[model samples]
Target: MNRDKVVLAYSGGLDTSVILKWLEIEHNLDVIAVCIDVGQEENFISVKNKALATGASKVYIIDVKEEFVSDYIFPTLKAGAVYEDKYLLGTSFARPLISKKLVEIAEKEGAVAIAHGATGKGNDQVRFEATIKALNPYLKIIAPWRQWNLKSREDCIDYAKKHNIPIPVTKEKIYSRDQNLWHISHEGGNLEDPWNEHDKDIYMMTVNPEDAPDKPTYIEIKFEKGIPVSIDGIKYSPANMIYKLNEIGGSNGIGIIDIVENRLVGMKSRGVYETPGGTILYEAHKTLEKLVLDRAVLSFKKMVSEKYAQLVYDGLWFTHLKNSLDKFVDNTQEVVSGTVKMKLYKGSCKSVATKSPNSLYNEAFVTFGEDDVYNQKDAEGFINLFTLPLTINAIMKKEKNEKEKQII
Candidate 1:
């Protein structure tokens, strides 16, 4: 008899490794481990070997770094999608892409169900399951944390020990972290306490801002229709561009954010994120937009950016509304082509200059210098027309007060 096959979103981490063994030993199911690489630094060969040694029937390691940057990261960057005005939606957007791959593999392998390592308490469970359901409603979903007897990470470690599964996490470094091309996120352990300041050792991607160099680093980033094309006059592919920026930005302590964000599951959780490259890209993109976009359009798009951020954070990427928002964002990006010069120092990326051929800024119109392009007399008629309703309201109030005085 053929044992039921299940596709597992395996990361070769402790949780997923334990789950892989449990699915085989306890449930008697054949497991196909799928690991999607989004630019995380890991030994794919070791990951595959460990999964096989731990009981996976097969392993599939897919490289999606380019797709992740161009499709997921760039769209969010162009939209300026920041969760709670701080988080860059790094982990949020990664989930949908991972789930998509899981579904695709499941279909190809004819797996009856899909399993994930996301804990029930976290937002990732909802994100993974939502994407899975949206893509394939008939497939069974197995979330090990919700159903398994292991109640905590400690228990998971014990199980790994009992089964002799080699894992990466240790008691001294128990922070659960997720990393990719866009950013690195730290959660769990000491981060659960709101008052506990994150230690410098917890950060993997960036140096501490105080430890950064005294001098600043400057770079020019060029964009075409909101997509970053080059940096410092050197053209790079999407993945390589982010890799280079991550190196430069991390050296200068460019992106570090500590946030207590409201989870989609209706709970507030705190996490520290390191998004060196993404931070630079977002600042450059917004600066260029300011150069090209009109005041009203830019203001309204800021509102749209917030909504778009929420949608991505809430795992609504596969929906019609999100698609429509993407179209709107793409339309707005048509004029968002330019180069922005920035200074990176002590965790800050400040735009010093920006230029775009589509810029709406007219020097003569706003300049105080003598020029025939704009006449000062034009302000008189404009102000009168603009304030006509206010003037009428004041006159009516004065007349009503006079009538009241007569009555008195």
Candidate 2:
């Protein structure tokens, strides 16, 4: 009898590699390893060979870097969605896209279930499962980390060893990492201790701040409708833009953050994230927005941004609220076209200057020098009207105090 096939989100890492074998051995299912490439540094040929060698009946290596950048990263960037004011939601948003691919592949292959390597304690479990459920509620979702007897990474390593499965991690250097076009996140091991300082050796895709060059680097980015279009006056595709910025920003030791964040599963987890390009893009974009957007619109958009971040972080990407917020974000982006010059030095990325065609800044009206527009006399009337409520309240309070003193 032919066994039922199950699609596995294979990353060629220890967790997913072991999960692939476990699903086949324990559940008697034919595992189809599906690797969705989002511009992470990986050898797809090696990943494919490893999956096949580890007893996967078949393997699919799909490149989705362009789609990831245009569809997911740009949308989040446009919304200015940052989780907890620190995390760029690199791992958060990728999970939904990965899960979407898993659902697609599972349906195409007529698979009965979709399996993943997300741990029971992390937010990824919720992110992956929520997207899966939203897309196709009929497919069964299998998460081995929650079901398997393996209590920890060590146990999983031992299981891999017994099964003769080649793994990526060792006990001495065990850090759970997720990488994509936007950023890379490191968790587990030393990071679990919030007090422990992350070692400089853990750095990838970036140099340490202390090791960065002494001189500062300057670059200009141009954006059209909130999406980055060029760097240094040269236009680039969405994926290429990120790659270029990462190279430039990484050398300057920019975009490294360490934080202890609350997980969706109701626990605190410490992780270090490196988002060189994304950090630069966010700074430049916000600088442009400040130049173009009105005071009230910018203030209200700040609230919407926080809510959008929560929605994405909580795995509500497919909901109606996020869709509505996306529309609002797009409407705001209409005037967000501009160029921003940035300076990068020693892990710092700052916007030095910005200009926009739709800028609200009026030098003629606010200039300190003598000008035709006479606004000096109008200020007295404006201030009186603005402070009317305060003035009235103070007068009433003084009169009431005088009456009380007389009676006493």
Candidate 3:
């Protein structure tokens, strides 16, 4: 009898490798491992060999780095989105793109189902499943972690060794990691305990503050529609720009965040993330937005940004509400075109100067020692009207207190 094929989103990690073997041994399903290269610094050639060595009938390595940066990273950057006000949405950003490719490959190969290594506890599972539902609801999702009896990484390690599948992780060192162009995240292991301090060795994309050079580096970023277009006036591709920023920012320990964040799965998980490029871009973008956006619109976007972050962090990326919010964010970016100069040193990035074509700042109105902009006496009328309600409330309270004293 001919076996039905399943396309697995393979990472060559212990969990996915074990799942690949288990899917074959237990379900009799022909497995095709697909790895999308999104600048994760992973060696896909060796991963392909390992997948094939472990009984995958075929292995497909798709170079999705440019697509990942251009389609997903830029759009989120344009929207000025930061999940939970800290995470640059690094790990969250890769899931939908990877799942989208999985669906495409599955359809192309006429595969009956798609599978992933995302566990029940992490946000990636939700992100992957939501993408699958949105893109190809017909495909059956085989989530082994949720269904399998094996409950821990130990079980996975045992299974991988039993099946003779090669993987990178070991019992001695186990930190669940998610990597992409924008950032790299470290979780599990010592990170499983919220109180454990992340050692300096755990940082992948940034230097330790103690180890960073005792000097500052300067940077200038050009933006259009809130998307960074250049570095120091030198135009670069989206990926190139981020890569450059990573080098500069990482050298100075500019973007490292350790937080025990609330997962969409109803648990708090500790994560140490290195997001050098994303950190710099966020600062630069906000500085420019300050130049162009009005106070009210900027403040309103802050509220909407919280909602957007919640939706993205919660795996509601494919929902209508997210689409509506994206529309709102995109509209606000119309005038958010500018350039910002920043200084990065010793784990700090601060904006120093900002300019925009659509800047709302008027030197005449803002000057301290001004002559022709307006008369100083005009403020008396404006303040009197503005204080009317407060003044009335105070007078009424005084009269009421006086009447009470007389009655007493």
TM-score on alpha carbons, each prediction: 0.99, 0.99, 0.97
TM-score of model 2 vs. true structure: 0.99
Expressed as tens digits, the lDDT of each residue in 280-311 for candidate 2 is 99999999999999989999999999999998
Selected candidate, larger lDDT, 1 vs 3? 1
Clashing residue pairs for model 1: none
- Alpha-carbon RMSD of each model: 0.9, 0.8, 1.4
- What does candidate 3's lDDT look like per residue over 1-408, in tens digits? 989999999988888899999999989999999999888888888999999999899999999888888887877776778877798898887888899999999999999999999998888889999999998999999999999899999899988877777778889899988888889999889887777888889888898977999878998899888778898989998889889999999999989999878888788888899999989998888888888988899899888877777777766777898889888888988888888999998999999999888999988888898569788899999999999999999999999999999999
Task: Give me candidate 1's TM-score against the actual structure.
Answer: 0.99
- In model 2, pairs of residues that clash are none
**Worst 10 contiguous positions by lDDT, candidate 2:** 366-375
Worst 10 residues of 3 by lDDT: 308-317
Each candidate's lDDT (Cα)?
0.94, 0.94, 0.88
Q: Against the true structure, candidate 2 has what lDDT?
A: 0.94
lDDT, model 1, position 218? 97
